[model samples]
Target: MDKTYLEINKQSWDEAAHRFFGRNPLPDYGPLAPSEDELNLFGDVTNLNVLEIGCGSGHSLRYMDQRNAGELWGLDLSKKQIEAAKTVLKNCHSPVHLFESPMEDNPGLPTNHFDIIFSIYALGWTTNLDKTFANVNQYLKKGGIFIFSWEHPIYNRVSNENSTLLFNKSYHEEGSYYHEAWSEPAVMQQYKISTYINTLINNGFKIERMIEDVRLTKEDIQRDSNRWYSYEKAKALPTSVIIKSQKL
Candidate 1:
């Protein structure tokens, strides 16, 4: 029998948690994207109750602490990640709460309570988008905001080869798929850009803003092709999408 998605991802993240402790944190949306200092997604987070899903290593929560949020809560699927978050947030100023749970399932968090809930490069880990976003809605108060970022739906289909860009896979194919020659036992889902927007709308969220621009200048694009998600490739198109929505 094959291992379940949750089981496999939990094991994978347990081993990989150390590499991601403080990487890709807040103040940045995603790979090669503009910093939050410029985007200002959550300006004046002061005294706001905030929650983070897939809160790997808790660095973003610490950032919220520095911004003086009223309370901080986070959850992740991996035990190693939850433990790392605890360690990372031990000395933080804000009152902190952490849970070990997958985003696909509810974990008794207070409903209609949080002022803001965000996930940084982590919403992609959810196996069920509707369930995940529904839980996000249940946890947030009326007019509260939910912000998340993920790799652009089209990023995986384009390749930079010998100074030329090539489109490989069919972009319309959206489902759970994995690269054959790649490593890691975990699986990922491919979503059409519109799929996310439509799903969030169905989940009772009002789309506030969506960002897909990579905001890089001539100096920022790298020539190296060996790197996974090369800046050269990201310069041609957006490597990630950031969305902010309000609970309606």
Candidate 2:
């Protein structure tokens, strides 16, 4: 919704690779391992065309290479992120296409050309949901898969790192949820669970599986509990939701 704000994010992401990847050019899957493991539910990737929307820093791009999937493409609104991602892929001869484009208006890609599309924690940041969903549908081949993980709509209500947990309104609303991450303003859009499910269904996609959980690791509880997440609150409620869907 905020193009200028998102543009700021684009610039920030490009400049943060030193902070993100650091001495390790590749990311080490610590807590992220659990999240990455969820990709298995989408089934085998061998020879299947795949696209990763919001492929920040190309960490997912590197992960996709291990899947042996057919041609892989990653699209993001941040050209800075894409530039850093390309740098990360300098020596790796993989079939990965990294592009700087809005997901809703991606260029040079034909419709019904991909077998799987996956985005992580990035879809809700888009300005337009309907057009985004339509674009997802347009790119997937029949029976292709679409999966994404995002900050739970409930988690969007409160942005306080120091604020204690408190009950909020019903989990349906239209507004901006703000958070400070990597010193950049992260904004999320609120949508009911049904709105997300219906958007996919209306676009000729069927939900294959959905998981809403607050399962946190011991490390997450110990190190980043107060700042990034709350152990007690997460145990009481979900913080993230990951969904897998199939094009009908």
Among these predictions, the greatest TM-score belongs to 1
Off by over 4 Å in 1: 1-3, 179-183, 217-226
Looking at candidate 1, what is the lDDT of residue 136? 95
lDDT (Cα, tens digit) per residue for candidate 1, span 1-248: 12387887888889788878888788877767776888999989999999999999999999999999999999999899999999999998899999999998778789999999999998877788888889999999999999999989898888778877888888998877653433567767788889889989999999999999885655434421236667678768888899999999
Error of 1 at 46 (Å): 1.1
Native-referenced Cα lDDT, model 1: 0.86
lDDT of each: 0.86, 0.69
TM-score of 2: 0.83
Error (Å) of candidate 2 at residue 51 is 0.4
Error (Å) of candidate 2 at residue 163 is 9.1
Predicted candidate 2 versus true structure: per-residue lDDT over 1-248, tens digit per residue = 45765666566656664565422111222222234454366567777788888777777766667667778788877766778778765655467778898776766776899988888777776767888898999899998899887767776465444546664556656756564566766555678778789888998999998877544777656644654456655765567777789998
lDDT value, residue 11 of candidate 1: 82
Which segments of candidate 2 are over 4 A away from where they belong?
A: 1-39, 158-164, 168-170, 177-186, 219-226
